[model samples]
Target: MELGVFLFRPLIRNRADFKQAEETLKKSEVWIRNIFKSLKEAVFVITPDRIFLDMNEAAQEMFGYTKEELVNRPSAIVHIDHEQYLEFGKKMEEVINKGEITNFQFKMRRKNGEIFPSEHTASLMVDNEGKPIGIVSVVRDLSEQKKIEEEKEKLQAQLQQAHKMEAIATLAGGIAHEFNNALTGVVGNIELLEMRLPDNKIVTEHTEAMKSSSHRMANLTSQLLAYARGGSYQAKTISLSDFVEETLPVIIPNIGPSIRIDTDLPRDIFKVNVDSAQMQMVLSAVVSNSSEALGGDGRIRVITSNEEIDAEFAKSQPGLRPGRYVCLTVEDDGEGMDEETVNKIFDPFYTTKFMGRGLGMAAAYGIIRNHGGWISVDSEQYKGTVVRIYLPAIEAEKKVKKEIITEPKLDIAEGEGTVLIIEDEEMVMNVTRAVLVRLGYHILEAKTGKEAIEIAKTFDGQIDLALLDIKLPDIQGDKVYPLIMKARPNLKVIVCSGYSIDTAQG
Candidate 1:
């Protein structure tokens, strides 16, 4: 017997000892073989020529090929039987000849033509002399695992979609609530005026209130559209310094009487290529929050500087990198927040204010992100709050003065034959006519759709250009425009709408 050929954890005593060792080796081999046979995994051996030499009982049961039919057959013959690809089989042969061990995953067919995914662990077999002989492969089906992975990814995407919808729904509700309150004030004022004012005197106050409220409505709609991530705007170079200075007075008053605003913006407009409207939004939301942080009586400082934020600086901030940027810092000595509260500042509907609901800062984050910029905030309770906005910088470009549009002057026909201006709002009509009258254009006025139309048909001879408002009582201006256009075909028509142009188009 070769030394160490069979291992027995005991002392050998002559030829009898050698015979006992041989019996022990035989018993161990039977035990290992029985264990292999019990496993459901299919086991097979392939000769160097890629021909199958043996298939375990499990393999035979799985492939529906008997030992007689499979042994001595070239591995390629099983291509149809096992649904293995020819290219993969060839690759396996190449790997075997190269004496490399490998594990493979593939789909193989059964006798019934049903394909199932499988994972295989295979290595070249060798004799006791370490000479290469054939290949042994242990294969297990992986169809179940693949199914689980696909289902997990599908569920993940669905969850993401659901989260997005829920966020948008919350934002919509916030905007709607604010808008309803504003509209109620405007509508109530107009309704009160309708009861007291005489037809001629109706052109006094509520109309201007209506116009102001209409513009506010437009502004609100614009913000909601941005939060909704819809609409596109043309990008252009804008001077931040000048824009901020102009917005200072407007934002300052909104902060209330308790706050003192000090601005440190450079005189030069730090120019950037972005939509001006969106930038205004970013400025407004941040400044408003800073103001609120002060709780009505504190000082706020807006400082702008040229900064180069490098990778190291960005690492501390997260999601930022080294770049030449313009930093706009809004700092306020007010009631500040903790670190945990700040991290979630950009999540929609996350707010510290009891009355505040929509995460307006989230809108600011999205806006800055879209502008190829980043925002970071630092704060501590009662110390102060500071928000730093890092925006990429561009080389200063030559400025081209924009051509201001001058309207063509209208030649007025000399005749004050009661040029009735049919508009529902009295103040807007009165103010407009006052301006036109100052310019020598005769003005006549009606306050509603029914009254305006009645005045138009009653006035005899060239009624002149009727300055018409599209929105009115009893009927829409759009419905009135066509009737006025058709009945008074010869009358010059000028259309006016407080908010939407659609009224006149109709």
Candidate 2:
């Protein structure tokens, strides 16, 4: 059972037989070394006492060690941690005594002290009589395989998140659409009622309250659509100074006095082409976040500035072109966020506030993107947060000035030219017709798009205006619009929808 006897012994009866035995023994030793060296997987032999007995060329390359350096070294040299070395030694003893061990995972350190994942299988090396002598292990590096697995997991998570956001957006859009239609009806009816009770102070006060409530409800619906619609926006040239001024009064009262507000609007007007309504929602969302971060006590500074992004600057933002932009920055002196929190702030349903639907930041992001603009957020744990919105700017000559006009009193009960009202919702149509009727216009009504087209064609084309709803039973109100236009091309048509302009497009 001895190692020397088991490998070198041969039957010999003469001098020639002795010489042949000696040659055969040398050849067998060469063949064994060659077989081990030719293996693709790293192969090494360790003694029962945990010493490195022998290793092949593949093993040398794998561990960045020479055969002379590894031959008598402790088997623990390949493992980084002392605890791991002791653990592997115990496992190796089991492999030497009990047959074999398969697929044992371990972290191995290379010559440069870099650690990588590996899997190894070991079997007992035995003598001619089957007594165990040493352990032979085959090791395979799993670094590349592990990387692939991790990347696949990351991609899977991203796909799942995208699907979830899309589902929520669709739901929000539907709810907003229905709610806006109902609000339109309620508000229209309340106005008509107020007109009838102008002289009655008691009734007028009640109607005023109802009108304010409906207006608030309409604002809520607008925010819902801002979060949901994944399409283009309706952009108009508007003065940024005027917009901020108009929003402050509404913002100041609701945010309370605990939060002090500061503004830095330039004397020279900055004009950006964007949707005013969506931008208002964006500002509301940004300020709401600031107030929440403040927890009812902090300062907010809103500043408007002109920005020119050159090619070098644009390189920082992929897909952005060099251009002039109007920057609206909102800075808050409140509880800020860490890197992890900031990364997920714009993701739908992500929130830190106690009272929130988790859609404020997400809606702000969507609205800005839809307006063909860019938004960036900078924050530190206690230093506070700054959110910057960059919108495309119009030329000086293209700037639009909004003039406030005071309307003189008009007689509310006088007859005028015939007007067409096309709406699918009965309640909405009825309330809208009554309001127009009270405004001294003869009303022509249709509960469906087809009925409206018939009415427009048969009439003498004297219709002053067409109040049309985009959604209809048989056809889209937009499609009906063109057909009605055939009868009266010069008709002043107004299309109404509860949904976003993109979703409502026929």
Candidate of highest TM-score: 2
The alpha-carbon root-mean-square deviation between model 2 and the true structure, to one decimal in Å, is 7.7
Full-model lDDT, candidate 2: 0.76
Per-model TM-score, in order, reads 0.38, 0.68
Screening candidate 2 with a backbone cut-off below 3 angstroms (N, C-alpha, C), the clashing residue pairs are none
lDDT for each residue of candidate 2 in 1-506, tens digit (9 for 90 to 100): 22233345677789998898878877876776677789989988877777888888898898999989888889888998889999888788788667767559899999879899999898777765677777778999899999988777755654554466567778878788788878888888788777887899998889989988888887677667777763335567687877998898887877858899999988576688777777887898889888888888989999998888788766555434577788899999887988777767777667675226656777887677556567778899899999998877776224322221222333335568777888878888788778877877888988888898898889864887777777888888769888988877877666667864332111
Residue-wise C-alpha lDDT for candidate 1, range 1-506, written one tens digit per residue: 21122222345679998898778867776776676578788987776677787767898887778889888887664454544556657656766667777787777777677778878787776555555567777888788898988777755644554366347745654564345334544654554454346474546565766768767776665455445443234457666677678778766666679788888888653566666767777888888888888777888888888787777666445445576677889998887888667756666668686216664776677666556677877889778889988777655323212211223344444445445577766666655565456446667777877776776667665666777765577887767777776767777656544332211221
Cα lDDT, model 1, residue 69: 86
Q: For candidate 2, which ten residues in a row score worst on lDDT?
A: 400-409
Candidate that scores best on lDDT: 2
Q: What's the residue-level lDDT of 74 in candidate 1?
A: 78
